[model samples]
Target: MSKGEETKTRILQQAAELFNQQGYAGASISDIMRVTGLQKGGIYNHFQSKDELAIQAFDYAIASISKHYRIAIRSKRHAIERLQALIAVFGSFAENPPIAGGCPLLNTAVESDDAHPALRERSQQAMNSWLNLIRRVIQTGIEKAEVQNNINPDEVATIIVATLEGAMMMSQLYNDTVYMQRAVNHLNHYIENNLKINGTS
Candidate 1:
């Protein structure tokens, strides 16, 4: 990459970490400059304003998570294994978080709900992407005869998304990973028993 490209990437990287740690409202452009050792002019040369930076940072965060998921789920051939891969991803939050802050999707959704429309839209897009992925997985399971034909992909997708996000919030609130694990475990059982064809109860 060119020197300018490198500097711009550095700024985005630092900004994403700061936004994740301090939140969009809590973290300032000055704070980002301080962390990146860039002058105000340097930042402005790349990003027009903090709002723009926050959106870019949010994108960067989502990209990071997507990259992780792509790599993590690549080897799994079975839809059930792919679904289990998601649980493993969440399970890792207890031990190793991919980002400094909690889940960016959750953080941005909650923080931007009232304050920033752009950020809120971005969060909504991220969630829809997640739900779409789950829905596709369920559809695949149905095609493979692993999941029942009558299973509602969208409904299951919503339940999984809601349950996982709620679990993450509760886990963060209590500073306990066990809450996430329990939620995921129950989700796994639900998928296995209810959705799977001839699944054992």
Candidate 2:
């Protein structure tokens, strides 16, 4: 990458961490400058405004998490395994978060609910992609006769994602990983006993 491109990328990385750790309202230009070692003019040279930087930073954060998800699920042939792989990624958030603040999707969604329309839309799109991924996995399993035919992919996907997200919030709130562990355990059990065609293990 060229020097300019490299600098822009670095700024995005620093800004993303700041915005995720502190919401759009809480994160200020000074904070970004502090983290990135870039002056206001330097930052504006790349991004037109703080609003623009925030949206791009959010995209960068989402890409980071999506990259982890893609790597985790890519090699698993079985639908259950793929879903489990995704869950394991979430389970790692407590100790090895992809982004420093937490789940970017959750953080942005909550903070941008009414305050920022642009971020709200971006978070919504990201969440839709996640739900669709889960839905596709369940559908594929059903087509292969690997999962129960009666299972509702949409409903199950919501339950799984919501459960994991909620568990993540609890883990962060209480500073205890047991909350996340319990959620992961329950999800695994639900998949085996309820969704799978046969309980293999």
Candidate 3:
């Protein structure tokens, strides 16, 4: 990449981490400067204002999370395996989150409520994308006869996302991996016993 492009990417990356760790209101331009080793002029050159930077940073954070999901489910063909891979990916975050603090979607969702329109919209889009992906996976499973035909993809996806996010919140709040593990284990059990075809699992 060109020098300016590289610097822009560096600024976005640093800002993403800072926002994930400190929230949009908590993280300052000075903090971003410190993280990126860039002056205000440098930052402003790339982004028009803090709001723009926060929006872009949120996008970067969600992209990083999506990348993690892509890597986790790359080789999994079946819907069950793909869903299991997602749970494993979330489980791994207890120790090492994709971004610095934790799930950006969860963090930003909590902080951006009525505070940041663009950022909150970005978070919502990320969540919608996640829910859509899960629903698609479950739909594919039904088509392939890997999952129960009567299963509702949208409802299952909502439950899975809700469970995973809640588990992540509890795990981070208590600084305990056991919470995440328990939630993941329960999700796995539900998937195996409830979603999958009787003989397929």
Model 2 weakest lDDT span, ten residues long: 192-201
lDDT for every model? 0.85, 0.91, 0.91
- In model 3, which runs have C-alpha deviations exceeding 4 angstroms? none
Q: Give the higher-lDDT candidate: 1 or 3.
A: 3
Instruction: Give one clash count per candidate, in the order shown.
Output: 0, 0, 0
lDDT of 3 at 31: 92
Write down the worst ten-residue block by lDDT for model 3.
Answer: 192-201
Report how far residue 38 has shifted in candidate 1, in Å: 1.0
Predicted candidate 3 versus true structure: per-residue lDDT over 1-201, tens digit per residue: 999999998898889999989889998888988999988999999999999999998899888888989988888998899999999998898889978999999999999998788887888899999999899999999999999999999999999999989999999999998889998999999999999887773
Task: Please provide, for model 1 over 150-190, each residue's C-alpha lDDT reduced to its tens digit, 9 standing for 90 to 100.
Answer: 99999998988888889888888899988888988999999
Error of 2 at 35 (Å): 0.4
Error of 1 at 46 (Å): 1.2
C-alpha RMSD of each candidate structure in angstroms: 1.9, 1.2, 0.9
lDDT of 2 by residue, 22-74 (tens): 88999999999999998899999999999999999999998998898899988
